[model samples]
Every structure is written in structure tokens, then in C-alpha cells.
Target: MHASREPASRSVVSDVVADCLADIDRIAREYLLEVQKIDDYAGSAVVAQDLEETAVASMELLLRLVGNLPIPDRLAGVSEALGHRRAQQGLPLESLLRAVRMDFRILWTAMLEKVPAEFLPDFTQDAVRVWEAVEFHTIRVHAGYLNELATMAQEKETQRAFLLSRLINSEGKDPQLLGQAARALGVKPESSFIVAVAAGHAQKAFRAGVLRAGVGQFLHERDGALILILEDVPARARREPEGTRAWLAALDCFVAPPARSLAAVPPMLRIALESLPVVTPDRPGQRTVRDAWGYVAATRLGEYGTVLADTVLGPLATISAHERDRLIDTVQAYLRSGSVSETAAELYCHRNTVLNRLARFEQLTSFDPANPQDAATVIAALHVHFLRR
Candidate 1:
């Protein structure tokens, strides 16, 4: 009796599927009209076509699944195709899923209307099977959409990296090519921009911080360092002081002065590179071209500055190294503080001890910290001395 009833159920299911297929076209049209009213698909012919095709394909899959036919290959192909098309159109996955659910609703409602009352009980169970097929189809679609989006993101990154490399290296000499590269990098060729170079380990965090602060756009990486091109850096600096400092502290960052044009980038980068070695190790965070200018000048002067430093601090050099270091430290503290008491406080020493060191320095160098002219000379000599070291 069970075996006899199996054929009867199969025959009834087949009839229901055939009826559904016969009305598939009408059902698809109604689905399309309803979906067109949705904002995501409104007035979009390509999206309309995609929706119509998806509805037709879904109905066909439902027919085959209900008829108990093996159509996994067809189901997979249609699902992936729908996902790939939607991803290419830059439509959100949620939108695609919403459309898929709508299709299921239309198809299921049509099937219920066409199925005979005698088979409604059986068809209700078959509806579960239909839902399972929809689940499988949706899984494949999601996978395809994610895969396509990944590929697209990778391609865009590759193009962006290439353009950034060309821009940094000044490979595109012509204005037209430079403009194209700048546009690809999402920067204006004529805009004033600053470039910051950061160490490899800190690059990712530094870039994230800059982006998070919304100060400017980070273009790309070059030579194990991250290169950031910032627009209106001075304004951003003023607006986001705390955020700017946070990222700057995370990086061994060197910033160039504003470049007037894309053509000026290479030279500006060179200047920033030249300024790197002159950055004092004690100053680890962001160093601008202006901040490092004194050291840069000392470095450029090289032997001349070294000789001047030696001659100016010659008396101190004659003393024991320890004593010389102490006296020099005292002078630096005094110069920085501009007062013996403040210098003593900073060095964690007695005021008399600081005063004594200052007296000794004045006696050895014949330059008084109290005298502006002599103090200027001592400061210049100290800068050169540090730069030389």
C-alpha cells in the first residue's frame, strides 16, 4: 500500500510543479513590477533584467526540485551567476537577499494557488524542501558575491599602489599622465600636500590612526615605509591636535613641508629623507622639516660646524670626560630653562650646584648665559656639537 501510494504522491507533485511552471512567466512579471517599486532597483534597467532572470531561474529550480529531479549543477550555476552580477553592479548583499526572499514568496504563493486541495497537505511538506533549496541557493550566492568583491578590492588596490608608486617616483613626467595618476590616487595634482614617511612596524597603526582621525588620505606604501599624502595638513593639525599627536607618537615619522605641486613631490621627499638622520634620537615622534632645520644645517655644514663647535667648547674638552659631560649638561639645561633655579629643578640638583656649573662653564668658554650675544654663540656651537656627534 505504501509503494502504491508513493507513485500517486509523485504524480500529484509533478502536476503541481507543471502548473507552477505554466504560470512562471506571469509570476515573474508580477515580482518584477513589485521589485521595481523598491528603491534599490527603481529605474535601473540592468537590475531589472537581473531580477527578472533571477525570478525565472528560481521558478525553474523550484519546478525541478519539486519534480524530484537532480539539478544541483543548474541550481549552483544560477545562484552564483545572480550573486556575481549583483556584486558587479555594486549592490549590497542584503538587497540581493531581500530580492531572493521576495522571489521565494511569489513562487511559493503561486504554487499554493495552483496545487489541488487534495495535495495541499503533501505540498505543505514539500514547501519545507523548497525552503531548504532556497537556503542552499542563498549560500552559494553569498559565497560568489564575497569572492567577487574580494577580487574587485584586490584589483583596485593593485591599481592604486601602481599609481602611487609612479607618483612618488615621478615616473609620470607629463602633466596629463601625472594628472591621471593623481586622480587614481584620489589626490589633486595642484593641491598643497605633505608626505610623511613612517617606519615599517608602525606603518599599519600609523595609517589607521591617520585615517581614523580623518585628517587626510593615506596613499600607499613604499620601500617598507608607509607614505601618507595629506591635504591641508596645517588645518588638520590645528583641528585634530590630540589625534595627530597620538599617531605621530606611534611612528618615527618625518614630515615634509607642503609641496606646491605633484612635480615637487620628489624633491620634497628627498628633503624629508635628508632630514631623517639629523633628527635627534631623543625626539622620536613626528619631526617636521622646519623643526629639524637647525640640525639639517649643522649636518650640511659638516666639518666647518664641527671645527667651530670644537673651538668654542675647547676649554671644557680639556677637562675630564665626566666633568666635561656634567658641565655641558648644565649649560644645556640652563640654556633650555633660561634660569639657574629652573635648571637645578630640571636636573634634580641643588641651585648652588647648577650655579657653580654655570660659573665654571662661563670661566672655561668666556661666554655668559646672561649675555645674549655670547648665549647665541654658545647655542649655535652646542647645536653643531650635537649634530656632529
Candidate 2:
């Protein structure tokens, strides 16, 4: 069976594989047996007959490729179906690759078995064509597998987002919709949750940050704001809403403190968004109602806030910037400490200096920072000025 040393022609290699076609059944059975050892394939639902058929077809495809014969049109669909089916079965891609690559080993072994030894190395040079065939099937298989995976993920996300919309928009009014969404989204009804909101412009950054931080679940844009619902599972301490807010603050988000039940999200979302106007660099990290109460009240007061700001604090705008800041700083410190001596201590100035600044503030605003009745108006006015800025 010895032959010339000149490299084997394409037709010679094709003949060797074509000869093995009679034994393709045995080669396919061996292919199936080998794949069963792979854990993912062993657990998958792909039937033995189907895999054997794919093995046989793949070998035939290699035969045609090496022979330079036209591949049957249907051969393309066979590989595509193989990849898609394995993907649908949830078999890990490595299993399919391992199984697909076997075509080369089994078919090459068959070809070598039938070729003359003197020409074996020359014939072995054609192994690259066998690999080309393997790669052909591999690329189509990869495409089909990846396409199916993308399709599945997109469909699941679309459905999840839709269900979540119903849950939040209906404000959990529909018990059935709430239950369905909760189940799909892995939210528990009895658990406490935090709903954080950011302006629509911050949606993309906020969402990416939330994902990277792993601090929450379920981000969606609703009613001109982007919101995320974080489940407060006690077992996972990091999921605490307050802790989440501390990190989420870096994302320019306002997070409502944890409240019982997902049903209460709509009202909490309102509270979350209400603080956005007050979230300046000086007043950043304000989340709940208590965090920014004055601003919240000012926002609720509507035009009255404007009127209060103009009547009570507008005169300060005309004063020298340094004097105005000194007076405002003394007044705010006095309000926080409730003692002239403590305000002076907090401001690192003598009692007379504090008194003089307070006097100047009274002359400008006509409200005593120490008087409870006047202090309330002054506080409201400051909130208006802060928010209006």
C-alpha cells in the first residue's frame, strides 16, 4: 500500500475520508460516547441519535471540503441547528466545542487508518483542511449559540421590565401583577425595600454605578426620574437602604429610607425625588424627608417660598459678599446650637463678634436668629434661598 513521497493530492485525502464514510456510523457512535463524559453534555437533553447525526454530517462536510466538492446547501443548517439546540438546552458552550472538535480526531484517525504508511506524513499534511472544516462548523455553531443566548437574555429583560412597570405604576394596586413581578424579579413581599431616584439626565450613570456597586436591584426610568428598588434583606447587611444611600450619594441619587412593603414605593419615590432641587454641593447626600426637611417644606410651599425669600432674606443679597457670608454663618450656627456662647465657640470667634454678626443679620433681615417665632421664618427663607439657587 506504499505510495510516492510527493505530498498527497486533495483527491487522495478525500478518498481516504470517503472510504471511512462506510464506517461513519461507528465513528459517530464513538463521538457520542466521548461527549457523554463531559459534565454539561451528560446533563443536557440532546438525544444520542441527534448528536450522532451531527457527527456524521460534520464528517461529510469535511469530506466535501477536502475534495473541493460543493457542500450541500442543507449542511449549513445542520451545524446551525446543532449549536442552537445545545444552547437552548442550557448546555455550556465548552461542551459543544468539545463535541464538535471530535470530528477532526475521529475522522483523521479513520483517514490515517486507511492511508499507506509511506504516504502517511504526506497525507497528514491535509489535517489543516480537516481543521478548516472544523472551524467552519465552529464559527456557525458559535454564531447560532451566541445569537440564541442574546435573544433569550433580551426577551427576559423586556418581560421583567414590563412586569416591574406594572408593579411600580399601579403602585402595587393589582395584587396579581405585584405577585407576578415580585416572583420574577426575586423581590419578597414581606421584605423592606428602598426606592432611590435620580433625575432623568442622571439615569445612565446612576444605573451603571448601581450595577458596579452591587448595591441594588431593578433600575427603571419612570415619571421623568430614574429609580432603583433595593431589597432590604436582613441577611445581606450591605443591602441596608441607609448604607446604600451613602454609596449611591456618589452617583447623585436621592434614596428614600427603607419602608415596609413594595406597595409603598410610589409615595416613597415622591419623597426621593422631592429632595433633588436641594441636592447642591453644599447640601449633597440628602435622601429622606428628615435629611432635607427645610428644602422639602420649601418645595411644598411653592410660590410662598419665593415670597418668603424676597421679603425676609433678599436684602442680604445687596450687602458685601464677605459680610453676608459672616452674618449667615453666625445665624446658622446659632440656630443649630441654640446658644450665643456655643455659636461663638463653634464659629471660633469671641462672643462679641458673634453678637455683632447676629446684629448685622437682624438689621438686614429684620428677624432675630435667636427668637423662635422669627427663627422659623428665617429658616424657611434660607431654605427657599438655598433651593432657589
Candidate 3:
């Protein structure tokens, strides 16, 4: 009686396995249709194939496990492979797992239909085994997905850095290579772009703000500054002075005018770098060379502006730095006010003190503040001097 029952049990399991295999094609189709209804699986033929194979392989594994046969190595391999494929296809892991759960539900429902009520207890136990195998397969697939995500993130960062370097330093780089880099960075080679150099410490915050504002931008850190290339950036996207003063209070930003091509970026970046010293802390954001004649002069003169400052302000050099700053401040106030009383009022000093400072400045520089011609030259020299300082 025991031998006869053993054969009968084996036959029942074999018939169950046969029924599962027969439903494999229909189950796969159903799974695909359900997934498609949730989201378009277009351009994902490879992913679909892997998922289908995984479904078929899962059923086979269930058959073998219930039959007391050895599990195939290909089962684990296919599970991991499907996970990696889904990850590469940029499918959300949750969605992938949900689809897997759906496949299991479909297979389990079919298995219930094939087993008789008398054998329902045994069949339910075998179904539990199949569910356990599904869970195990999910673990392997999830591990593979995580690993692929990490690797893909690393590769993307590496590519970003490489492309940024090419864009920042275009010397000897072929036009073709520059175009490729531009495309990778998501900017057209011929598109008008603005290059900005900002304080490196503010890079992450600045980038977050730019992206949040929906501006297309690429950024890289170089020499303690963050260099950014903004593609067709809207006027409103440019950092506003009041906003910068209120929020990114410590940052210094220099923006260049729109450039016609990627090749123009380095020159524009150079102008921004040269204009850095002219940017005052009080005027914290986004200074353009075109906004001020003084900025343009300072950028054009480069280090020569420092030499010019030294030559023009040489007479004041002999004085103590403290007295020098005081005299310079008075000169600035006098130039801005154009009247001794106004200058004194602005400085909260007596009018005699303003007059005396002006006299002393004239004696040191031989450019009298009282005369229009002399005042013009002195004011221009002061701009260059203070800009460099």
C-alpha cells in the first residue's frame, strides 16, 4: 500500500508540473499586459524578455522543488540577471517587485485550479514552497539591482567630471570632442550660454537653487571656485542681488554675457576670474562685466590694474595704512557727494575735516578734487585703485 501511494503521489505532482508548464505562455502574456497597462514598457524589449524568462524559470523551479529534484543553477542566474536588466532599463525596483508578485499570484491561481480538493492540503503546502522560492529569488534580484545602481552612479559621476574638464579646458580638444562633451552636458554646442564662477563653498546650495528654479546648468569645481555653464538660462533665473543678499549672504558670483559657442567659455571664465577682485562683499551676487565700465576696465587691465593702482596712488604709499584708508574714504565720499558739506554730513564729520582731507589728497596725488579735469582723473584712478584693493 505504501509503494502504491508513493507512485500515485509522484504522478499527481508530475501532472501538476505539466499543467504549470502549459500555462507558462499565458501567464507571461498576462503579466506583460498588466505591466503595460500600468506603464508603457516601450523600448524595453530586453527587459521584457528577461522578465518573461524569469517567470518561466520560476515556474520550472517550483516544479522541481515540489518533485524533490535538485534546483538548477540557472534559476539563481536568471533571477540575478533579471534584476540587473531591470535596473539598467531604469525601471523602479518597487515596480519590478510588484510585477514579480503579480506573476506569482497568477501562477498560484493556476496551480489551485489544477489540484483536486482531496489533495488541496498537499498542494497548498507546495504553493507555500513556491512562494518561498519567489521570495528568495526576489532577494537575489534586489541585490543585483542595488549593485547595478551603485555602479551606474559611479560611472555617471566619472563621466560628468571628464566632460566638465573637457569643457573647462578646451585647448587642443577637437571640435568634435567639444560637441560631444556639450551634448553629454545637455547643452547645444551652438547654444548661447552664460558662464559663472562662484564661491566653491556655495556650490551645492547654488546648484540646488538653480535646479529648483528649473534652469539648465552644468557645474564643476576648479581652483576653489564653482564654474557653471548655464544653457539658455532665463533672465529671472540669474541670481538676484536682493535674493543673494538675503540668503546666500557670503557668496561672490561673477556672470559673463551670453557666449555663442563652447569655445568662448574659457575666455568668458577668464573675464569672470579677472573681475573677482572688483566684486565687493556688499554687492554679493552675479556681477557682469558689461554692467560697469569699471568692471570692464579692471577685467581688461587684469594684473596691470594693480600696477596702475600702485603708480597712481604712489604718493599716498608713504602714509600709514590707517591714514591711507581714511584719506581714500574721504576721497570716495567727496567724489560721490560733489560738495564738502555733503561729504562731511555723509561721513558724520565737520566740513573742515572734509576740506583738510581733500587738500591732503591733492598734495599727495597732485590731482586737486576742486577742479573738474583733476577730479575726473583722480576719480578714475580711485576706481581702479579701490577695485583692485
Candidate 4:
């Protein structure tokens, strides 16, 4: 009889409980569907955690609706859940705000079936304020994350640049790295090579340009020296006139402090390196470009030949090496043996001494003193000594 009397209250309780059950099912399904979409967007297996968290959130709301907690407590729980989800995503405030707004729209549509129409406005307004707080904190986290990433990128670039500079300046000097650097810099590495060494301490820049222009090859500079590797020329450049022109152009345009001297490898390289004018006393002046090359060629030959000659002649002679050299001049004057007196007069030498040196030369060479062939051989030897030294 007592249970029958409270039927209206009992029916109202049953209806409310059923509505809450249905609301829980709807929220769970919606949360699952939304989480799947987010997971697809994130493209990471980590998104599964966020999906589980969302499922937990829907369960919490369901418990709240069923009176497992007081209204205020339930609202706090929902706020905490939303904050956790936003933090997990590392989303900015604006993005979280947008997401929260969407959540409210969905919840409002679902609650319309159970919650009083008059209560909807107040509920949405309260939930939005809580979501705004969550958004603000999450945005700060997102901004910090972005700043860290930017700093990392800047540091990486700086490290890369330093390594590249060190590689360029290294002394071991890898050929591949040099070729790659030349390619990157738009310079040709393969070309006829030449070296123009500038003198004086202050004219380094002038030296650089001269060396670069003269070589027409990739230029690599070091302290007081520039090493040029010509990529264009083959292992041999015997007698190329065009190659010579290019070498000259380089010397003419770039060298400063005026290169006192230039040298190249391979004896035949002069076929190219020689075309360039030497640094004259007037530098590009001196109407007669008299082959200064003879001097260079002679000097190089003398380096080796002098050793051989010194071994044979000893240090002593009728006079000093210089005087002996002067006496040798008589050979040119005696082209046809005009007369010993004439040669002596030309050389300012004594007649008997000239005859004695001729006798000594014939003895050493095992040739007859008076023979024409012996005279010619003596002249040829003298000529080589003169030209090489």
C-alpha cells in the first residue's frame, strides 16, 4: 500500500534515470567517432591514448549525470577532463577554444532531449568559461614548444655553417671537397693552371686577383701562397699558344706588388706559362720584351749542371769561377779562330793563357787541339754552359 501511494515520484525517478543512460550512450558513441577522426588526422599511434582519455571523459560525465557526484563536483571533473585533453594535444588556445565550442554545440543538441530548455543557456555559458581557461593554459604550452623547435633549427644551421668553413680551410685539403666547393661557387676547377707569386706584404688582394685571373683555374689561397690546380689542361700541355694567352691574361689582370717570378711544373709548360709577359723593370713596359724566359730556363738548368761542372772543374781555375766565365767569352769572338791575339785583345786576356786553357780542354776531352771538330765541340760545350746558367 505504501509503494503504490508514491507511484508518481517513482515514475519520475525511473524516467530521469533512463534519460541519463541514453545520454551516456550517445556521448560515448560521439566521443569515439570524434576521437577516430582526430586519430586519423594526427597520423600517430600515440593518438590511441587521447582516444582512451576521451572515453574516460564520457564515462565521467555519465557518472555525474547519474548522481554519482554532486553537480558542482561533476562540473569540476568535466573541466579537468577537457584541460587534460587539450594539454595532451599541445594545441594553442584558439584551437582548443574552437574545439570546446564544437563540444558544447554537440552537447547542447544531445541534452535538449532531457535537460530543461530554460537551463541550456546557463549550462553552455558556464561550460564555455571553464573551457576558455583550459585553452589559455594549453596555448602557453604550445607556444613554448614552437619556440624550442625554432631554437633547435637555428642552432643546427649555425653548426652546419661552421663545419663547412672548417672544411674549406682545412690543410689536409681533400680534392673532392675542393671540387665540390668550386662547383657550388660557380668557379671552374679543371683548366690550365699558372702561379703568380706577388711580393710585398700589403698587396695581398692584388696578388689574389692576379693569381686567379692568370690561372683561369680554381683558386685556393693560403697564408702567403696560393695553390692553383688547373683542371682544363691534360697531363701534358706541350706547346699550346692559346693556353699561353690565357696564362698571360691571368698574370696581366690580377697580380699585384708585381709578381717578381713565376714557375710551373713539367719542362714543356712554357708552351703556355711562357706566353705571359714577365714582370719587367718598367712592368709591362720596356719596349723590348726580350725573352726573360731564357734567364729562368738557364737558371733552372744551372741548378743541376753547375753541380756536374763543379765536380769536374774543381773550385780553382786560371781565376775565380766568375773570371773563368769571363774568359769563356773568347769562344764567341773566336768563331772562326780569327786570331789568338784578337780574342785576347777582345777578352783582355794574355795570349799564352788562352792557348794553355785550349790545350787543357783538348786533354780532358781526348780531342786534338788543332782539329776543327775539337774546336766545334769546345764551342758547343761553352754555349750550353752560357745558355743554361
Name the candidate that leads on TM-score.
Answer: 2
Compute the lDDT of residue 34 as modeled in candidate 3: 68
lDDT of 4 by residue, 33-122 (tens): 664454333553335566556554544443343323344554444544454445445554454444444444444444445645554444
Query: Distance from true position, residue 104, model 4, in Å?
Result: 44
Model 2: how far residue 263 lies from native, Å: 3.0
lDDT of each: 0.73, 0.75, 0.69, 0.44
| lDDT assessment of candidate 3 | 0.69
lDDT of 1 by residue, 45-96 (tens): 4555667778888768766765666677756488778778788887778877
The list of candidate 4 runs beyond 4 A from truth reads 1-175, 189-195, 199-220, 226-241, 246-307, 320-323, 328-389
Q: Which 10-residue window of candidate 4 scores lowest in summed lDDT?
A: 254-263
Tell how far residue 356 is off in model 4, in angstroms. Answer: 12
Against the true structure, what is every candidate's RMSD?
5.4, 5.0, 6.2, 19.4
* 1-389: candidate 2 lDDT, tens digit per residue: 12323344655775676787777777777767777888887767888777777778877776676556677888758777877888888888987888788778877777789887776767777778777877887888888899889988788878887887677567566778767877767777666777878744466777788888776456765556777887766333445444355567676667776766767765676677777654545654435566678978987889988999899988998899898877888888898878999998898999999899888888888899888999999988888887787
Least lDDT summed over 10 consecutive residues: which range in candidate 3?
240-249
- Is 1 or 3 the stronger prediction by lDDT? 1
lDDT of 3 by residue, 84-129 (tens): 8788888888877876666567767777788888987765656665
